[model samples]
Target: MSWLVDKDWWMKTYRGLIVKSMKLSFEMDQQATDLLSKMLDGRGNVIEFDEMKNLFKEYNESIVFGCGPSLLPDLDFLLESGNLRNKLLISADGATSVLINHDIIPHIVVTDLDGLIADIAWASLKGSVIVIHAHGDNIERIERFVPMFKGRLIGSTQVEPRPHVYNFGGFTDGDRGVFLSRTLGILRITLAGFDLNGEPYSCPGKLVPFNKRIKKKKLEVAKTLLKELVSKGVGFFNVRGEPYVL
Candidate 1:
């Protein structure tokens, strides 16, 4: 249900989409991937795939937090409703800092090494299992930060699977975290702060520097990939905005 299934899923479902549609550079992704493997093999404390799977058993349910506008409000609702007990908190990229700032250190964090490095580092030192995603844009960061990260490191990539880096059937950091959860055998996943359509009127843009249209396109891709995952008999419940639509 893990290694074999994951490899098949990556090839069958995601690889073509990444290469043909998204037009991602396979060469660059592989370069970043090889760097990750080198770090894992030589200088890093890379968590073996099986050992990483065992860590997911600490909680069967996980709430994946994105940097959408509803993120904080949803966390507040979960706290007020008293339904957050025993939930494995997984922060996607920048959400790690938000969660830590709120005094709730997530049990795991997923990132591409683009967020505030110091915040991610703090969470790592405090025992969060950091799921590091390697891709074209962050090869430098992979070399710079990986050696300094303190806890268990789970390596991820989209190009291909390796002894250390893995393909878990997701594209963006947020959905990639969800895919990782499901691939590791966790069936229940919740989404928070995921504004698929666009940023709300009251909220600043998620990635303000990028063109809004491009950001919207990326969000739609994430939503589509997540829906595809759900269509395959996985359970994903949205905690904010409209329920998931296929």
Candidate 2:
């Protein structure tokens, strides 16, 4: 039988496995929260929900770009597609550099401050809404980079969201871009540069590092989440070579 025929069973099984691993994840998130608290310490502005809603009021379609190596070769096609003009362009952190290099600035960027901070900050300065994520593993990064931003900022957390921080339900930066678009009520979302089967691209040395095995696992989780979103009526299209449908 096809896996889709037993979707409920698979989802339950995945949830059970993830639940067993959530403790460690939660502990790390708590640690990151503590660090973020220290970093913000009365500084920096968080975008309110009303403000975010207002920003996306006119947008209905979004194109979310991931930073898998395959993204580099596909950039030309994406730029030439001509469909980008009217759609809200959302870039996963690392993909910001690529987009910037191609003179295509995203309307929003989802990052863990793990990619090139300079690129992300530049994009923010150019009017891209920066959705920065806080997690235990990137505490030092948040401390170092958060203060460097001078444009629109939105903070997200994996745990409970508060006044300045929000949680939209995603694990990595790439998937977070989708979550952000979905949360904003985008009617359609097209994904590009998402090669879940391959290794994650490496960023600058000072940026957050990448581990192949960990990234692969994260991609699996992302795929599962994307599938869940599909089951819930969210419209998703994959522009990469083969369409990745739920």
Candidate 3:
């Protein structure tokens, strides 16, 4: 248990392998394998596959975000900007409040319960779809969330043997949210606060130096995937005060 926290080499090697595996899976389109690796976190967990795909099918477009309080600066502008209309939003576990505080509600909220459990229940009760990423550890959160919410649960494929999470290289679930959004036929995707290589000082919070390395690597992955998506006719934009097509 102490090694999981205090050992730098352990994390670097394991997470590095996960990153390398993701590159391979993306090349091969073995998303199930990629997702399984992501879910494992080098600890342990088994992913349920059938349920995972079903969860992916429930949305048309997804706006994934970190909602790290810094996004509040652009929340209102984004909501009024009209680009996100009809898009399904998958707010990352703790970031849901960015939408709620600004009066912009999401279609669904996905989380592992690091924070803001009460807000998740509120969002769900208000008709927001909730997708809880279940693992061997968070059984309690999963059980609690399932009975309370009206939405589906997308079991992460990363929980299986050799687990991986394929987020199209956006770094975290927000980037994965965007990846999933594009894959589901959303022609245009605009990111808010998906500062891939940017220091997480404000809106999305700060990622430490080690995690930052992984993030940079993920951004490279996202660029390639987004390029492929564009070749397939998907468009991407970065939204601040206005949405800029990238």
lDDT tens per residue, model 3, 55-128: 45655545566554346554556667775666566676557766776666676565644446667677866756
Candidate with the larger lDDT of 1 and 3? 1
Q: Pick the candidate with the highest lDDT.
A: 1
137-216, model 2: which lDDT tens digit per residue?
A: 78778878888887778777766454466667677788878877888888588888888766655644336456766666
TM-score of each: 0.88, 0.84, 0.57
How many clashes does each candidate structure show, in the order listed?
0, 0, 18
Regions of model 1 farther than 4 Å from truth: 1-9, 12-15, 200-209, 240-243
Task: Kindly report which residue stretches of model 3 are placed more than 4 angstroms away from their true locations once superposed.
Answer: 1-62, 68-70, 80-84, 134-151, 159-171, 201-233, 240-246
Ranking by lDDT: 1, 2, 3
For candidate 2, what is the lDDT?
A: 0.73
**lDDT (CA) per prediction:** 0.75, 0.73, 0.49
Best by TM-score: 1
Which tens-of-lDDT digit does each residue in 1-246 have in candidate 1?
Answer: 134345666666555665565666888998998888778875456677788767767788778888877888988887777667787788888888788887888888888887777888899989888889899878988888898797788788886767677777678788888887787677778887777766632222132254565566567668778887777777777664334553
**Per-residue lDDT of 89 in model 2:** 90
